[model samples]
Target chain A: MIGSEEVERETNPHSIVSVENLVKSYGGREETVRAIDGVSLTVEAGSIVGLLGPNGAGKTTLIKSILGLITPTSGSISVGGVDVVENPNRAHAKMAAVLEGARSTYWRLTIRENLEFFGRLNGEVGTEERKRHRQFLERLNLTEKMDDVVNDLSRGEKQRVSLATAMARDIDVLFLDEPTLGLDVEGSFELQQTLTELAAQRGVTILVSSHDLGMIESVCDRGIVLDDGEIVADDAIENLLDVLQTRVYELIVEGGVAASTRNEIERAYDVVSWVEHRGCTKLTVAVSNANRIHGLTGALVRNGLQIRSIRMDDTDFEAVFASLVYDRPHVDESRAARGER
Target chain B: MIRGRRGRLSSSVSILRALVTRNILIMKRYPLNTAGAIIGLYALFLLVYLGGRSLLGPGFSGTLGALIVGFFLFIMGNASYKTLAGLFATEAKWGTLERLYLLPVKFSHVAVLLSISSLLVTFFIGFTMLALMLLTTGTSISLDLVSILPIVTFTLLSTIGLGLLFGGATIRYKNISSIFGLVKFVFVAFIVAGPTFEEVFALKFLPLVQGSYLLQRVMNEELRLWDLEPLELSVLVLVGLGYFTFGYVLFRYFTERARTAGVMGHY
Candidate 1:
């Protein structure tokens, strides 16, 4: 998908958000920390990008630079074709962000007032903007609480209001950090659904950064993973999985396996995680070779351990992320310890 | 959506209107806070008037009229100073400061709109408190709009510069709010400063003091702004413009520094 996009000069012509070699460093020469080191990527129009990274992986630094919250030490960012560094005010009109999920709106302001304030600031006026406001209120499910001050809202409701407040603006791009942070199951699902609608229906490009891999899997068209201030992987979610061959499968056994079988299982397959749950052992086994699942299952049954459930976990982004950053060497490490490398 | 450079005038008005609307809505929401502010304003004035009266006894009547004018200017100066300087810190506290930076216009443009809105509100509150003080004391100064308006405008203009400077300092060195709170008390010094432009020519541009002197004359002598010496009026206008320009440059510098430092949301 990234290759299919048309390139004009260094950046894709259709990309609503583009950054080239962005480098942001903090502190001085003796002990400089490059928070963002030579990062470059482009988000095409209307695509939801999930920026996945561990803590201190430069995700925040990258988002802040693109949003014009902070200036990059080197390189360039452009929003909707306006160079961010050269003309920030012009680029600002094209972007908005819910940086801290629920704290974006004024706590003392009523939900409607917050919307009106942000909306008007985005250049939407009186009667002309009512329809847009009404639509988002309805979609975000804040219609009933429109008259209520934000301070009275529950955490979930407040997060929705924050999203609504940011989205109410006339913007071509929206950057959300931890978008599903305060949401429960239904709230997170609804937010994903709304984000899907925003991208698909309105063609509003979104760049979402969250540790919620499941939510990211459900909503994003592409996933970009960062590690140690550099991008470890960037591609379509399915492609990332396919290329990494992250054939991770979760095996829930009826009971705990004997020490010998467990040791043998660890030696045979790459065990990503082993946990005991409800008197059963849950082993996340990574099958590097896609055809090796049957061998592992046969060995498990032959060892007198009754199989409870077997399903491929490759569709889970956590598996793909682990393969990318935790490194595929996890299996190689296990094998090489026995001189298999 | 942003209508490009062509939308400059319209968007500016829209932004100003939005700020005014947001402010009024907040004020309307907290009626008690608004009322409390007025009462607090009056209480401070009364405290000063009583303290001075106690010290001077009956002779305080001679300075009563001057004290009233000084108190009015102090309210304006104090409010003006706090409004601009405290704005960034409060917004940062509320988490809306970054949003202001994200506006289509320069961040300073948003500050100006905010300043205009606050100016109107502070003026209303200041005048109301002024009225309350006059009613309690049964004394009135010349309320000539032609004379007082320009002088008051210049006085506010000068503090805006301080606001910008302190505001910029806030982004770089956050949680300096207590410093701004203490700085407002310096208005007392401005109030007591020598009021003669002829005595000290350099004193003409001394922030609130010079404006206070001109305003004291306007209220006491019923003198129009034009009635003042040409040099005095020009210098007053220049001082307002000069301080504002100084403040804006410093604000821009600190804002840029804050961006480089990436500490806008530190507080």
Candidate 2:
């Protein structure tokens, strides 16, 4: 986790978007449901941040609140240094979004009309001004389908059109929710490239939420994982791996693990996956401490289970994400999970 | 300070033009729907004109001028009542409602712009239906823009206000088209209320009913808006502004509730 000093710096002049102590609650006073509970974070300019979470994790709610699509019960959200609640129109002028539902464009309007209409809505009416938006279509490989109505396009094409529509205007910050949901490999890659270029070349900050963990790891500069309406993990991509500190190992044993032995293993190790055959058992377990490796093997041998092979498996961001969100005991969640130190 | 906020008039005009163009293009794409609506409206008017004339017999002193003016105002009311509410409900289903809030203007601005767009098109259709009625019934009426425009404006404003109330509710409630049957009954009452009923103060206050009565005065008596009593004009203007302002406020309130409740994108 970053120090408090880093958070202070991050929330300074360089921060284009800042959300503070946001809380959105539902239901009567007798029963309360908070969609986002005191979730705070700052997105610096020209950075790509991935919002990762399981279903019903308040990712969409957070994004919506930041975009001023939904009002938080109590909090402050600012975009480009403008308070969203006090002056949403000004905040919207500096922002754009491809929300969760990929139906932002008029289904009957052609791609050309969608681009033109959105451009004009954002005050980019001139031919020269609109021509500047062509790069979005080109990057999404949708320029050739300019005359096609959104209803006629394939699912991937429709999503790209939505992306192009969101990115068609001059915007400093862009919010996308599950943008890669319906995209194929090529479309996903092109979208990633577009995001990278927007951040690297234009200094446009992006906050995207998607279930595709691999894509988030590959493209995003930082990752934020939310669970149960709170931000449980927020850090750089590499730092997330470093902070997880858990090792995934594969243990192949001769003769299957009896129910009693399996129960013991479950009690000790964080088993990621388990498989058993006629005379073999393959167990993929996550061990937090290095000393637990020998301990596990010694216990297995003591239980009359012969260890055929033991090796460390590959580790990815998913493990780190799972550790933080699943409330694993090894990490000090209060100190490590909250990236604001 | 909105970064690209223009002088009031210029930005309003730009957004209105864009919205009008969008509505026009979408309407053009569905020629069948437009043709079907025109035919259905024409047929309904034909039913009223022919059936009323036959039912009352010759010397049925129901002047075509009043009928035409009343029809025009009714059409205006119908447009005002349905356009905003229907557009919003459809936008919710299309999942485009929340996206409009992303635009660099207030959602109310877009709502007003959309109402204006639909009003302009409704005017076109109103005239077309009038032409058809004139041709079919072999009737004549004065078409004075000077006398008719003010009444039409007030009537449209009142109906749009009523529509905004529903439009706002639809964002949160999702499906409320069941109330349309009641609106149809109200239209019938507006047409059938007699001169005796006009004596009642409350009857005179019915939305678009008041405008219809004022309009008939112009078409049948050859009067202009200027010749109308100050009390008459004042009451109409007051009702129009009052209903519209109330509806607009309700719509804004419902919109905020929708945002808070998180149902804007749900159909």
Q: Highest lDDT, which number? A: 1
List of clashing residue pairs for candidate 1 = none
lDDT of 1 by residue, A172-231 (tens): 899999988868998888889999999999889999999999988889999988876777
Worst 10 residues of 1 chain A by lDDT: A1-10
Place model 2 in a CAPRI quality band: medium
lDDT of 2 by residue, B132-205 (tens): 87788777676788888887788678888888888988887878888854785686577456233568778766
**Candidate 2 residues A1-341, lDDT tens each?**
73222343244778888988889898889999999988888888999999998788899989888877787899899999889988888788898888843588898999999888877776637877667767767777888888998999987788878878887778899899998887889878877887888889889899999988988998899998887787777889998888767788899999778888888989988988779877898989889887999999998999998999999966798877776776634234644666623
The global C-alpha lDDT for each of the candidates, from Candidate 1 onward, is 0.83, 0.80
Per-residue lDDT for B150-177 in model 1, tens only? 8888888888888989999999999788
Model 1 bad stretches (over 4 Å): A1-11, A243-286, A293-315, A328-341, B1-6, B194-198
Sequence-dependent TM-score of model 2: 0.88
Model 2 residue A324 CA deviation (Å) reads: 2.3
Superposed Cα deviation of residue A83, candidate 1 (Å): 0.6
Clash count, candidate 1: 0
For candidate 1, the chain B TM-score comes to: 0.94
lDDT of 1 at A318: 78
- Cα RMSD of all models vs. native, in order, equals 5.0, 5.0
